[model samples]
Target: MADKLKFALALALVAAGVVGFYLLGEQPLVLRVLAVFAGVGAGVGVAALSAPGRRFIDFAREAVVETKKVVWPSRKETVQTTGIVFAFVVVLAIFLWLTDKSLEWVLYDLILGWK
Candidate 1:
């Protein structure tokens, strides 16, 4: 119940910030932008107090940690893999083109005598 209230308050805060931005049409751009940022920042702070919010933050942190631990391919390995992929793609394209031409020849020249 408390968590739901917190979430709702957060959403309201964000909406208010957006509304304020539009409402302050005659105001300076800096002020309008500041209003939006303040609202969103406050909303996020409120939301972060909720159970689900905490879980999401934890998940995000863990994701960053895991991403950092990843063994990314070196430049050489990346280039080699890319070259292999391009070669395979070229070969496949040629094979497909030959197959299509053979089918077309069989249908038009041999069977229908249209060519």
Candidate 2:
């Protein structure tokens, strides 16, 4: 129940920031942007006090750690893989075009006796 209220308050804070941005139309652009950021920061702070927020924080930490363990493909390997994909696509396109032309020849010239 308390967590839900906290979430609701956070949402209200963010909404207030957006409203302030529009209302401060005559104000400086930086101040208007800051208002939204301040609202979002405050809202996040409030929400982080809740159970779900803590879990989300934990999950984000875990995701960052897991990402560090990833082995990214080297530039050379990436280029080679891209080249292979392009070659395959080109070959497939030629094959399909030949098949279409062959089918048209059979249907129009042989079957219908029309040049």
Candidate 3:
């Protein structure tokens, strides 16, 4: 299929860029950036040519549209949730640190008999 060929060509381009990055050691920064871009373009082009890629693109577009229709949380709700998360994180961190210290003390002092 034509799609297969395009995919193969894109893969080839990406492979060439990877190889070039290692081989073309003294190339200018601009050239290197261009090579990387070319590789990415080739991959996207190949994916575009494939049926699955088209399906994925369509699904992604629909998801974005749906996301736009969402009613996001208000500022107050966002702040409260963020504060709660921060407090939980701080508490969890202290708990973990205490646990780690207790384990270390037990292992080094009691089990191994090391001061």
Candidate 4:
């Protein structure tokens, strides 16, 4: 219950900051930006104290660990894969273009007799 209230308050602070940005349009740009940043920072700080926020932080840390464990492809492998993809795309495009031209010729020259 307390966590929920903290989350709600954080959300309200962020919302107020966004609204304040518009309301402070006549003010200096730097001040308006600062106000918005302050609001967002405060909201995030408050929300960070909640259970869900802690869970999210844990999840993010786990994700980073998992990401670090990933075996990324080498630069050479990446280049070879990209080259193969480009070759396949070029071949498919040529095939489709030929198919389209053949159909156009058959329809106009043979069947329609308009040519």
Candidate 5:
């Protein structure tokens, strides 16, 4: 029950922020943006007080920890892999171009006798 109320309040805060942005359209762009950010920040703060928000925070922390455990490739390995990819792409492009030109020649010059 308490969690639901907190979530509702957070949603209201966010909605109010959006409404304020449109209502303050005649104001300076900087001020309008600031108002919107302030509302969003407040909404997030209120949401963080809720049970679901706490679970989300826990999930985010776990994700960061798991990310840190990943084995990233070295700069040299990355560069070599990228170069290999580029070479393969170039070869494939040349092969396709030759295939297309060959088909065009056979269809137009040899088969159709158009030109």
Candidate 6:
């Protein structure tokens, strides 16, 4: 409860600082930096206050650990995949161009009676 209150108070101070800056027609850089830092601090305070937030942090930590266990693709594999992607793109472009020209031929020569 105390942490929640502190979080809210910190957020309010950040908000007030921003509004005051705009109202006063562009405040100092130091003040803006302080406001941003305070806002981030408030967010961290809120996250620290709750069990669910802590659980998320723990899950993220475990995910990073597990990620380290997996083998990443080699540069040779990456280059091969990129080559396959370009081939597919070229094939699809040819297919689409054929379809478009066929549709144009049918619509102009057959339907509307034009050359």
Judged by lDDT relative to the true structure, which candidate is superior, 1 or 2? 1
Taking all chains together, the TM-score of candidate 4 against the true structure is 0.87
Show model 1 residue runs off by greater than 4 Å.
27-31
Residue 64: error of model 4 in Å? 0.3
Whose TM-score is higher: candidate 2's or candidate 4's? Answer: 4
Q: What digit string (tens of lDDT, one per residue) describes model 6 on residues 1-115?
A: 7656755765676676566556645768777667666666666666656665677789999999999999999999999999999999999999999999999999998999899
lDDT per residue as tens, model 4, 16-106:
8888899999999998998899889999999989999899889999999999999999999999999999999999999999999999999
User: Worst ten-residue run, lDDT, model 4?
Assistant: 30-39
Model 5 ranges with Cα > 4 A deviation: 1-5
Alpha-carbon TM-score of each model against the true structure: 0.82, 0.81, 0.66, 0.87, 0.83, 0.72
The lDDT of each candidate is 0.98, 0.97, 0.85, 0.94, 0.94, 0.77
Over 31-64, each residue of candidate 2 has an lDDT whose tens digit, in order, gives 9999999999999999999999999999999999
lDDT of 5: 0.94
Rank order (by TM-score, best first): 4, 5, 1, 2, 6, 3
lDDT of 3 by residue, 1-115 (tens): 8777777877888887777666666988778777777787778878776887788899999999999999999999999999999999999999999999999999999999999
Off by over 4 Å in 6: 1-25
Q: Identify the superior model by lDDT, candidate 1 or candidate 6.
A: 1
Top-lDDT structure, candidate number: 1
Identify the superior model by lDDT, candidate 1 or candidate 4: 1
Q: TM-score winner among the candidates?
A: 4
**Candidate ranking (lDDT, best to worst):** 1, 2, 4, 5, 3, 6
Q: How many pairs of residues collide in model 2?
A: 0
* Each prediction's RMSD to truth: 2.0, 2.2, 4.2, 1.6, 1.9, 3.1
List, residue by residue over 1-115, the lDDT tens digit for candidate 5. Answer: 9999999998898888889999999999988888889889999999999999999999999999999999999999999999999999999999999999999999999999978
**In model 4, how large is the Cα lDDT of residue 44?**
93
lDDT of 6: 0.77
Task: Kindly state the number of residue pairs that clash in model 5.
Answer: 0
RMSD, candidate 4, Å: 1.6
Error of 6 at 24 (Å): 7.8
